[model samples]
Target chain A: MKILVTVAEVATVDDEFEIDGTEIADQYLNADLNEWDDYAIEEAVQLQEGGVADEVVTVTIGPEESEQTIRQALAKGADRAIRVWDESLEGVDLLDVRAKTEILKAVVAEEEPDLILSGVQTGDDSWMATGVSLAESLDFQWSAVVNDLDHDLEDGTASVRRELEGGVEELSEVDLPAVLTIQTGINEPRYASLRGIRQAQRKPLDAKTLDDIGVDAGVVDGSLELTDMYEPESESDATVWEGSAEETAGELAEMLREKGVTA
Target chain B: MTDVLAIADHRRGELRPVSYELATAGRELADETGGDLHLAVISGAVDEFGEKLAREGVDVVHTVADGEEFNHDVYVQAIEQLVDTIDPQYVLVPNSVNGLDYAPAVAGRLDLSIVTDVVDLAVDGDSLIATREMYGGKVETTTELDAGTALATIREGEWPEAEGTADASIEAFDAEIDEDAVGSTVTGFEEVAGGDVDISEADLLVSIGRGIEEEENLDLIRDLVDALDATLSSSRPIVDNGWLPANRQVGQSGKVVTPDVYIAIGISGAVQHVAGMKGSDTIVAINTDPNAPIMDIADYAIHDDLFDVVPALIEEFQ
Candidate 1:
């Protein structure tokens, strides 16, 4: 069995992200692997180590900086890494979701993996629908927010349990060649050791452009443009609780009722 | 015919509260476009669910009797076929676990412009402008579709529930679901980690975090919960430690809550945890760290220790 895991490289903004007119203050941002994709990478490695998959491949789409992130995945146990980046892919609000999905479809077509796993959503972009959209673009059945997963290679099915709102868990069974968006707490990601990191430097890491994936630059258009991003205005003024604990407690209760927060 | 299609979501025969919310939003769009608002419900038996959706603004309730619960294959197949028949300008679904499952497929298959987690909607000429939260709940963005059909999933709790009480007419439509095409079957829903409390419905939330320090200290927070008649919830740290059940956790990973008042104690607000409770009407934070992220958004903040402050809050309520 073959499994493909996709990860995103997110940036940690220093201070609050700022805006000078319509342009953003991009200098404060430093790219790192998205927090949510840790589970996807870990799940992929676990499936391989457990013999559920014969191979595990990691894919990412970002600038050249994302290669570092792919290597980190390699260090953790991915068999190989492929990154999609082009000069045209640079800047904010570009690289349309459908176009990105198409590029991924091309990769999937080339790899012909039986299973695909991705983070439920990225820390940035939060394009929450991309994983399912990718599945749709590929004409594959999918389940989102999956927490528990088990594969029956002989039966040609996968048991997936999803984490839903209000703490509700739903179990489902999907046939082979499916897409799943993994939620957190599925597995504990192993830290890359010195030996693993050294070995990762020698692993197979490839890069591709839109042309290489057979996608036209004309298709790369922003559906949602970034107008302006800045700090929101304060909700309201709040009186600080002062003096000793006992007196403040009394004041708190009175205020709760005053605000109609307590009946 | 080019109107709005709102999907009425239900689980185990009960209408999810967000169904009414979507109906309300759907009606607004229908009016703006000068077209009728149509609602869809797919289950093995749809009469009960269909009648519930027959509201004032709802011109028609499109029902498809297919399965007991939401199935991906059924939803995608049913909704895609429904769009072709109704010729809707906008497709509205709740940005929920089940809704997100099939919404993307519908949008991808149709090649429609999709905007998700929508909190607000407006019509500008032929484009539907959608307002949604970006970068956690810190920033709000309004998205304009550049395509013909708009596929969006609304963020629950941000909009008021639909109050249109008109008795809408029901219209049954076949999704033509082929069992062979269905790759998955939903079996059952189980409780995550055996927690019974539904925090989303709480009127007030008294949430704790790492500041409480240890498992033994949970009693102090519980005391406050009982005094104020508030629900006990926590951030991911406490849940990760097993100090509280996963259901008691409040964050992006747990549940999104919108209550009248949220009193966050010893909780340093991270982006993930803030997303779940930022819709709160009033926010009060108590922590020694005045620089904590939770303090910035708090309506009222007290810079103090949890052990000293929580006990006092309990006494004041008493």
Candidate 2:
């Protein structure tokens, strides 16, 4: 079995004053691998370690700098990495759902991997629909927010535990050659080691472009446009209940009751 | 005139409330777009449920009673047949497990622009503008569908359930589905434990998060829930740590809840967690940290240690 891991970079806020400031669109930039993507990579690594699969490949579509994010996945144990590098890809307002569907469709058509795994959602788009969209695009079965996975390579089926509401868990089996989106808290993602980082630097990385991937930018006209960004308004004269622990508790409880919170 | 079709979801021969909510939403959209509302029911012996749905301002209820259980291929084929016959302007489905599985296939086959987990939908001139949370719950983006026929899987609990006025006529439609197309078969069905609570139907919920500390502390929240007769739920962290079952989790990765009163105890309120419960009518957050994001949107906030506040609340309720 071969699993492909896709990663995307998102922006981080530097100052509270600029929480929603437009400057974040520019200055707050860096290619940090999404936290959930680590889960996907870790699952792939576990599959490889168990000798269940031949290899695990990491893919990312971003600027040249995104190669670092791909490298980060390699350090976490991806067998190889591929970067779809194109400067024109920056600020392309495509949600991960649409962008990943286009890219994964192209990649799946070429690789035809037994299974494709992705973080349930990316930090940037966080739509949590990419896996489903990619599955639809490729006409494959898709499972969302899988917290546990047990694959049978011989039978081409995977037993998965998915979280339901009210502390219930549901187990389902999906035939392989499917897409599974790994949810957070599925496992403790392993940290990159010096040895693994060094090994990652030596691994093969194939960089391609939109043209190479056969995704014409014209087809994906930015459906969602970002008009402007601004910081949230501040609250004035917010009451602070400060005192000893017991005193503060009493005051807080009185306030909550007054607000009809404890009724 | 164009029409809007909503697929009413049912499981184990019972109608889910979200199906009614989706029907209401579909009716509203259809009215705005000058179209008729069509409700589609797919299940065995669904005539009563189909009539129940027909009362909700729906022009027609198309019932397909073929299988004893839900088959993705069967649903896809049924939806395709309806779409082909009605040529609806928009297809609205609940963002539930069944809808998520089959809606995309219907969209793919019809080559329609698809949007999932839509929290807000509006008719914008000739297009449909669907608003969804991005970056978990940190950002909201509105996307306009250029395609004439758009398909959206609305997030559960975004719209109010419209009670049916009276019974209406039900139309039985035999969906054309080839047995050869049904590749996957449900060998069996295993019901998950604690499926009885139906957290989605609970009007009042008291949810706990990792801040509750340990599994034992859950008793305190449970006591409070008992006092209020509210359902008990948790964040993904507590469930992931095995402190609670997976069904109790409330978030993007778990169940999206929209209770009338949601009391969050010791939950720091990650964006993912908030996205699931933000639709609650009233939110009360209790956390030691005054800076917890959950407190930001909370209707009421207690900035005291939950250990102290929870026990006191439990005592008062008792």
Candidate 2: where is the Cα deviation over 4 Å? Answer: A11-31, A96-99, A161-171, A222-246, A253-263, B166-168, B187-233, B241-293, B296-299, B302-318
Clashing residue pairs in candidate 1 (N, C-alpha, C atoms within 3 angstroms): B56-B164, B56-B166
Model 1 lDDT per residue over B85-142, tens place = 9999999999888888988888898888787888788888877787766555545666
Q: Residue A7 in candidate 1 has what lDDT?
A: 81
lDDT of each: 0.81, 0.74
Q: Quick one: best DockQ, which candidate? A: 1
Clashes of each: 2, 10
Candidate 2, residues B1-318: lDDT per residue as tens digits? 479999988765678788889878998898899988888999666787777786667788889887766666788888899999989999998887667667766776787777888878888788788777654444556667774787898887778887846455589988878877664454444434345566778887889998888788888888878866778998877876677776687886578889877888888787668878989987877777665668667876667777877676666545
- Taking every candidate in turn, the Cα RMSD to the unseen true structure, in Å, is 4.6, 5.4
What TM-score does candidate 2 reach? Answer: 0.81
**lDDT (Cα) of model 2:** 0.74
- Deviation from native of the Cα of residue B117 in model 2, angstroms: 1.9
Which digits, one per residue and each the tens of the lDDT, describe model 2 over residues A47-118?
A: 889989888987776777777778888988998877775556665665435655787688777777888888
